[model samples]
Target: MEALGQAITSWVLEGHIVEVPGLGNIRAEVRAKAKSDASDVSADDIFRHHLLLTPTKEIKNALNSTPINITCFDKDGNEVNRD
Candidate 1:
């Protein structure tokens, strides 16, 4: 899990597209904060970074049609499952 998380973070930060198996692509993008036509814009006035996730059609369909299960470890190191 740690390795996968690190890979996703590194790829996204480098503005590279990453395709996760059974999922879609993950990418980074930058956008202007303001939608004005004025030419008075500075670095601080822009939204520098954003992570975008485009999930695959199969994932989307499964998400809509099937029950999802989420498992996590509790503070006491006990496994918990959520639906």
Candidate 2:
């Protein structure tokens, strides 16, 4: 697990999309401000960095087909609701 995580991190850092079988593709992204002049743009213009994950069709289908059950309880330990 640790090795897999390291590989994913390394690939993303290298500007490559890393695909996990049966899961999704993960990539690093950055959000930057637009500058009026090209020369005015710099690394400082970048304000946000994030990771994006695009789930595989199989994963999405499985999530969509799965049923979720929920049960709520009161502080008194009594059942309040169920879904």
Candidate 3:
């Protein structure tokens, strides 16, 4: 996480992204741009945020490029299947 933070900081400071070869590029953007909006009920209003990431074509293609195996268990250690 620290590495990601540093990379993002650099990106923000540099105003451009730098590809780290194997890892990918360090990108910094609003992510979800901050804004202001209110809900009628005043329950959940997400108007402020950061800009979204617009990864390079290559980077975007790599997203979810790797497959992983996930497993979860209950209190008794019994496997829990999504199905």
Candidate 4:
């Protein structure tokens, strides 16, 4: 498990997308502010760097098919509503 995690991290850090079986493709992403002048742009313009995941169809389908149950309680711990 550790080795697999290391490999994923390494690939993403190297600007490559790593695909996980039955899950999705993960890649590194950055959000930067746009500058009118190309020369004005720099690494400082990048405010955030994160991972982006594009889930597979199978994973999306499984999530969509799953059911969610919600229950609400009153301040006194009495059941108010159930869904």
Relative to the unseen true structure, what is the C-alpha lDDT of residue 9 in candidate 3, on a scale of 0 to 100?
Answer: 72
Off by over 4 Å in 3: 1-11, 32-67
Superposition TM-score, candidate 1 onto the true structure: 0.58
Residue range with the least summed lDDT across 10 consecutive positions in model 2: 17-26
lDDT of 3 by residue, 3-68 (tens): 977777767676776666555555544333334653343424344434345566776667768566
- For each candidate, the alpha-carbon lDDT, in order, equals 0.85, 0.95, 0.60, 0.95
Candidates sorted by TM-score, best first = 4, 2, 1, 3
Tens-digit lDDT string for candidate 2 (8-67): 999999999999988899999999999999989999999999999999998889999999
Q: What lDDT score goes with residue 56 in model 1?
A: 97
Off by over 4 Å in 1: 35-39, 64-83
lDDT score of residue 78 within candidate 1: 94
Q: Pick the candidate with the highest TM-score.
A: 4
Model 4 misplacement above 4 A: 74-78
- What is the lDDT, from 0 to 100, of the residue 54 in candidate 3? 52
